[model samples]
Target: MDYIDSICNASASILDMTPAVRKPEEGKVVLDYILDNCAKWPNKIFLTQPMGGDEVLNVTFSEFLSESKKMAAYIESLNLPAPSQIAIMSKNCVWWLMADLAIMMSGHCAVPIYPTLTAETVKYTLEHSESKLLFVGKLDTHPWNEMKKGIPAGMSCVSFPICPSDVSYDKWADLIGDNEEIKEIKKRTPEEMATIIYTSGSTGVPKGVMLSFKNLTDTTFGLINTTHATENDRYLSYLPISHGMERWVGECLPFITGLHVFYAESLTTFVQDLNRCQPTLFLSVPRLWTKFQLGVFKKMPPEKLQKLLKIPFISYLVKKKLLKALGLNHVRYAGSGSAPLPPDLLAWYRSLGLELLEGYGMTENFNYSHMSKPGGGRVGYVGEPSEGVEQRIAADGEIQVKSPGMMMGYFKNEEATKETMTEDGWLRTGDKGELDDAGRLKITGRTKEIFKTSKGKYVAPAPIENQYISNIRIELACVGGRGHQAANAILMLSEDAKKEAAESGGKDAIEKELEELIKTVNSGLDDHEKLQFVAVVNDVWEPENGFLTPTNKIKRARIEEEYNPLMEEWYNSKKKVIWHKW
Candidate 1:
């Protein structure tokens, strides 16, 4: 069977599971939930952030409300016009959420910028959003000297307590009064602007996506109902809160559900934080999941683990022990999104007793489009449309969606906004997808990323690339061949793989293993889709290197552009794979 047919067959069993239709809470906003929770669960731990050496800072529901009110009062004191724009550039932290809540409380729109963004983009976002005030917090990787130049001259700025920058700014502590009492909360209507989140464009300039209070609240409620999450659940906030997925789920979801959230201090403390939080709900991207698998293999080789899993009683104990060691034994709902996950990887996780639910959504939709249900083992598909979400595949294979959570539009870009949505009002997702026989959506590739080969046959790279990276050794694999006879790939070895290669036969051993991996992957593809040659690059893709988005998604177009010059020479080489010497 072909690709579409195979997906349908795989999803046949779960097709009968209908999605739950939950009505959004229209009368209440996210802020209302926070205020109500404060009254109901005043002493409950609302947010947690780790410091060094077994020390952690916990904020109770009451304290969160009080602090946010004080911050809002300070913001109101600024005397900025109603609905003024305020920009926040920070990593995920308690202050980020407090500032966001404060912005809404003061009747202003919050604009979030990824903390890792460059000075040029930062300046462009600040100017384009027309933000009157800025909250600078936890800018670890940002070039402060160069970035401060981008801040509009004399623009009022407040520095978080933990901010390491020497840039001149008013301290958040001095701005707030001793008394937490503030003016009565300003009630915002459902249609009132809440935030303008700029897209972390993997290609080209980032555009501000305008979202209303209604959009975010509706999406949060939908997710809570669909996932069956409750106040007892715990969440870890580590992903960049500037990204829409983290903003909605990691930040907004906690307010609605009253779930306790723990913040990772840094990458070094990620494991310790996870163990301390023991989060009931966890969301991670595909790359991290692969890393987790690699971590497991490091302790016990994959071959050994597979053989051990085949044993009857020992397999159960092994799986339990392995999960606990990874600090995921308590994770009831594990989700993967922001990129497509390979089917093999999903199955591998399932065997270890962690059902990695694949979700499908984008920044434009408040990251609430489709998600796999618990106990529903639909491996390759992203499950059915979410509650109150309508989806259809366009004639050209793009997935179109209409939902209450959909963004208002691209902020201040009318022409681009018009082009993004259909005349009939469906938002164009720009992703090529197909609905399986079970009505589950399976994303095939990106519309703009598909390339036509010299043989006049079009090839979608994502699916092939996903297959290629299924091997744990292959960290990143970018597939492309716009005018070539066959598709080619640029492969980067995983960190562990690189170390293993260096220890064991060096480049020759790495090349041999990669050649075998390519042969194995190509055997599963059709002639036109098979990778003719792969250039093994030593450099790893990273956000700082302009190869990955802040959310850790590969920048496909950027990778292709960077490696275009080396492609022809690699393709002309006699060997099936060429090791690129960078």
Candidate 2:
């Protein structure tokens, strides 16, 4: 049978159950929800932003509505074209949300640019979207200085209170000072465009994903239903809000659920902010999660902690203290996404009584695809399809999905849009995956990332890389084996690991540990998939250096271009672990 026929037969039993749909009121756009909340809870605190140490700015529902209205009025007074595209380039802060609401209120589409993006990318996004205005807020001074050069000299710009003092743009307070609230709030239809979110661009140049009101509402409402979100829940917003995952979970969900959102002040104060908020719902990427685990290990050595956990009474106290220290004590729903989470990490958190869920999605679908449910999770699986989402596997093992939250198309890129969708209207997720009998999905590898070895065997890098990254000493791992005798990996050591390596006899100890780790990892792999060597690189990989994306995803093309030439030399050396510095 053909791929479609096979998919239909395979999913027939799994799809027999009725899928979850959005609530009646959930069909309304985000603006409508904000208005309803203003009427229902005018005095309720909705957003909290940290100004600095021990000082925070809070905005209530009524205050939020008032400020959004005044900003909307100011925007309308400018008399740009109706439904003009406006861009907000800022970090996650209270003004980012206010500016977004104002843009929607003024009958304009919003475009969000990652705060960590380079000047070239920022320029490309603004020019591609044809944005007429820009709002600048909360950014690192150095990146802001760099990104400011990309703004067209003729384009009008507005600055939030937290913006750099040196900027020569019209201040937000000044623009709204004299303008009256708009007489009528412009309401948008479900089909109307809400935002154009650019992808994080791990493989190539970023593409703008055009999302509508319906797309946002469906994903937000679906999450609310699944998580049982309420106004009492608190969320800490630390992830970049420009990405689809954070925008949907941290920003849009609050509009519908009235959840209290606390903005993290800075990296140095992240744990402090988390402790203050004690959020009830938390979302993070695997890298941060690994860091948290390392922090815990630093405080209490793993061997000692394991011994203490053997005692029943001490185990409870240890778990509670650990969660409290991480500011996840009150977290009822914790999610990890954007990259594959190691199963070991999931088990570790679960042992501490945190039900850490693994979710799978893409920007093209507004990040509504699959999410593990409470008490129904299996290790190494991304769980069943999310509410109102339908998924199937193609003949080539690629996973295809259709969801109510799917994007309209790429902005001004019809050819790329066509390449991303199937003839039957499903989004072609480049991920290769399989469905369990219960319809849970497990990703195998990316179609574009698989490479061939000299032995004519195919190698999937992600799974092998996951094995290496599970070691606390390793920070990032990349595997490549195109025309090579065997697959090999490049690893960057964690900060603490690097410090340890600098000490007397430390380098030898680490080399021994890494050799053991390699042996352990190879035991689980097939003959061709086993890594031939582990090369420790001396360089750092970050977004500023063009080695990683703004979302912490590695830039595969750039990394390969820089390192592939040395593969033959490293292989011929016949060393199991080679430190680049040595």
Top of the candidates by TM-score: 2
Off by over 4 Å in 1: 1-24, 142-149, 165-167, 177-180
Which 10 consecutive residues of model 1 have the lowest summed lDDT? Answer: 1-10
TM-score of each: 0.94, 0.95
lDDT of each: 0.82, 0.86
Task: Report clash pairs, candidate 1.
Answer: none
lDDT of 2: 0.86
Model 2: per-residue lDDT, tens digit, 225-340? Answer: 77767789899998889888888877898988899999999989989999889987888878899999999999999889889878999999999999999988877778786788
Query: Which stretches of candidate 2 lie above 4 Å from their native place?
Result: 1-22
Report the lDDT tens digits of candidate 1 across residue range 432-551.
Answer: 899988778888888888999999999998888898788888878888999988899888888887777677477777778778888998898888888888888878788756798878
Clashes of each: 0, 0
N/CA/C clash count, model 1: 0
